[model samples]
Target: MTFADLALGEPVLKALREIGYETPSAIQAATIPPLLAGRDVVGLAQTGTGKTAAFALPIIDRLDLSQKAPQALVLAPTRELALQVCEAFEKYAGHLKNVHVLPVYGGQGYGVQLSALRRGVHIVVGTPGRIIDHLEKGTLDLSELKYLVLDEADEMLKMGFAEDVETILAETPETKQVALFSATMPAAIRRMSKQYLHDPEEITVKGKTQTSANVPQRYLVVQWQQKMDALTRILEVENFDGMIVFGRTRSITEEIAEKLRARGYSAAAINGDVAQPQREKTVNQLKSGKLDILVATDVAARGLDVERISHVVNYDIPTDSESYVHRIGRTGRAGRSGDAISFVTPRERGLVKMIERATRQEMTQMSLPSVDEVNETRLSRFDDRITAALGDSERIDRFRDIVAHYVRNNDVPEVDVAAALAIVAQGDTPLLLEPDAEPEAPRERRERTDRDRGDRPDRGDRPERRAPREGLATYRIAVGKRHRVEPRQIVGALANEGGLRRDDFGAIQIMPAFSLVELPANLSRETLDRLSDTRISGQLIELRPDAGRPQRRTDGERKPYRDDRGPNRPSFRDGGDRKPRYKRGDG
Candidate 1:
């Protein structure tokens, strides 16, 4: 049924219609009504299943926007999810006046958030640590909070925020309605839900088999610079009614779509920045053959249904399996055969296995089309044009004679003249792709001069250092939670390339924007430099020797009492409470 059929207010319905959301997703339709009725809910759904809207709509509909001071609170596992939920609230509440949604998280200063809270807000979406920090300082008031949402509760437990989550739960009013959503119901999350949510109504949305069976999936390994050329070659070799190319960001989507159009392909970009009316027109054009491709981001393409989409190309591989499934699901509709192609960089080959496991389907590795194949396809299409014209020979008699007269009069060979004409007709698009080149072997990182945008702020107070080990030395890396860098990735990059055993890797502490790992101390400068060039999460590794001294805390500043657990203590992300995960066998 349409979103209008749900228990939503006029303002929310108006916002939904303007956002181009015509229908409720499986989770949204099931979860919204219970939440609006002031009942606690536990939603079992995977990513990309409209979980944000499911909770956001009902909260906005029932929220007393006039009575500010955070009537609702949402805790997310990551800053990205926190910001995403906050944005959804703003979008859904666009028609409602004086509704303020503030997102509080680390890596951002507190003054702005404190100011916003002082000014009064309706909802606060944040990560556990930052939210706890505010609560301890008495800057955040949850006394009036009528609704409490634990988004991705499993993820929170996985991130070692269970203790903090429990603390926050204890502080909230017992009368507050609780809604907990998790992709997987682990024992911890289940127990917490039972304890926190009062007789919650449970709703489950099965994610497996979500992808269509009629679609055949394949992937090609290529470098980042060669993606455009590879896409062009694949398009030439395949037959598609309409294709949707998915990119990670709005600008990337628009760039790919514009390039395709400039190369004479019918293409348009459907992104969040594009007005809803324009997005609808673009999608309609693809359906009507006015466009052969619609480049889009994940959110922009959500809930889009069309029978004409025969191919879905992952120009950029999705970071998670849920997104990959959602992208490929655009095709294979109406029981029609469809194709899903992914472009994987050599460094990202590991993701293929992850996607396969999630979808429960093997993805065949397809070689990139050769230059010869592209030239052959171009010539075949060129010949088809001439053959089709021959069917209308009578109508083209005058033009055909004009060509013959020019061929006879020109003092050049007929073949040469025809080649020149073909060159003119081919325009700017290259008829052949560049030869494929072998990629270099992976290397370790060295100290970097330039800061990665993902780099987290240094611990204002000195960071804890590991006690001196016999052969292992500590090094700091410039990527952590912000870049989505995990501990295994650090171990995998170094241990795999440096001939070090998994046991050789030592304690890893992941901070907001950086991490500390212990490796062999006696590594030469050359090895350090080589390691610096290694890639993780598509960003080059920026590693340096970790100084053992503690950073000095400002003399006048008041700092929270930190339980200085030893460096070997398991950080939160290692199943949050489990033993050290870097010890080789834990994985």
Candidate 2:
């Protein structure tokens, strides 16, 4: 049935029409009427099944725009999903004036959320953890919340967010209309519905949640650290019209997108923090062929229906099979054949089996493209490029004359001259992947033994002050122990802001007042400035090149040791009573 049959407001219908959403999915058609009638709904539908629109449309239709204090709240499992739901709300509410939808989640600074809350919001979509944080801080008031939605309810429970979810449900008004959507109805989820939902109208979309058969599923067993390298090789070899690389976290999406762009690929990232207008623009660019690769978190890519997307890459595998189904569904749309590739870490092998069991489809284990394969692909592409350039006979004739002149003056063979010109056209980059530059094999990771029990691991109290890796330089930032900042916070802030990967960092020493981190030595001024402005734990990072100051001991006291011998060896101090000499095995 059409949205009009459900009696939705004109603004929502208009927005839907503009979005080209004419027909409602089964779950939407069933859930919308109950929700509009103010009846609680328990929607059982898989991901990518128009679940967001089912709840979002009615919520927008029922929203009292004059009363701006969060009329509706949606809690999603991840920050990515939270932002995705928030974006959907904004899209559906476009015709409804002054309908502000804000998404709150972890890893984002609170200042933006606090300001938005103070200014008043019509709807708030957020993760359980961040929503709880705001509630505790009294920054978010849900007393006026008329509708409470738990999207991906099963996912929230699987992520161990059930406690936080219950706490949030407790805080909301008892009279609020609740819509609980889940892909699966596990026992725990069923109990939750019984506890939280008031005689919820049960609606289930029957059928096993499976991806399109048109999409050939394949997986690569790769190490967590080598995913980017594997992805680069895949991009080079795969013949794709458009691709979406799904990252598990928002920072990771940005990191992957940045790396792809640096490697000369047309790519961009979209996540919860990206403004709705920018997100829409990015999606439009992907549709219009202006962007080739979209690195996105699951939620950011939710409900993204682009017929041009011929491939989907799971740079980081989803925690659950449902998300995997949703991610791959981005491709194989409109009856087009698509390819789905997932990078599974060795530790996450079980997840693959789980997905196979859930979808009843075996994902072919695919090996990463070897160096030889990548080189072959590159040579093939280079040949095709030359052929395409030959089509431009006018330009080729002008360049050929210049090449002929060079060959005639230098007394070189015409073939040798053509080869030289080819080299010049190829530029400074190597024409092929080096034999030694292959990515680390995932099998090696699986075969690794645990460290010796006798060996002492590095502790925060005694951080090792080792030199940075080759081609890396030490940099210092002003937030540290005093600010209660962890190494991850520093990495997350820098990586998300600067578009660098986790491997880009070397040693990260969190000092009491400041922290020293190792980064690529050749950072551009613009990147450094952007990193410098990044905030960690509410404090500006103030990132800058380390001044090579004499290393300080963690403790207040220090012993005089020979600089050449290193800190492990004892040395004589000038003021000491006697010069103490130490020998091997000396007590």
For each candidate in turn, the TM-score is: 0.60, 0.63
Off by over 4 Å in 1: 207-210, 213-215, 220-232, 238-339, 343-357, 362-367, 370-373, 379-421, 425-587
The best candidate by lDDT is 2
lDDT of candidate 1 over 108-134, digit per residue (tens): 667999999999999999977678778
* lDDT, candidates in the order shown: 0.76, 0.80
lDDT of 2: 0.80
- Give candidate 1's error at residue 10 in angstroms: 2.4
Please provide, for model 2 over 162-258, each residue's C-alpha lDDT reduced to its tens digit, 9 standing for 90 to 100.
Answer: 6678889999999999999998899988998999889999999976378889999999999877888889889999999999999877778899999
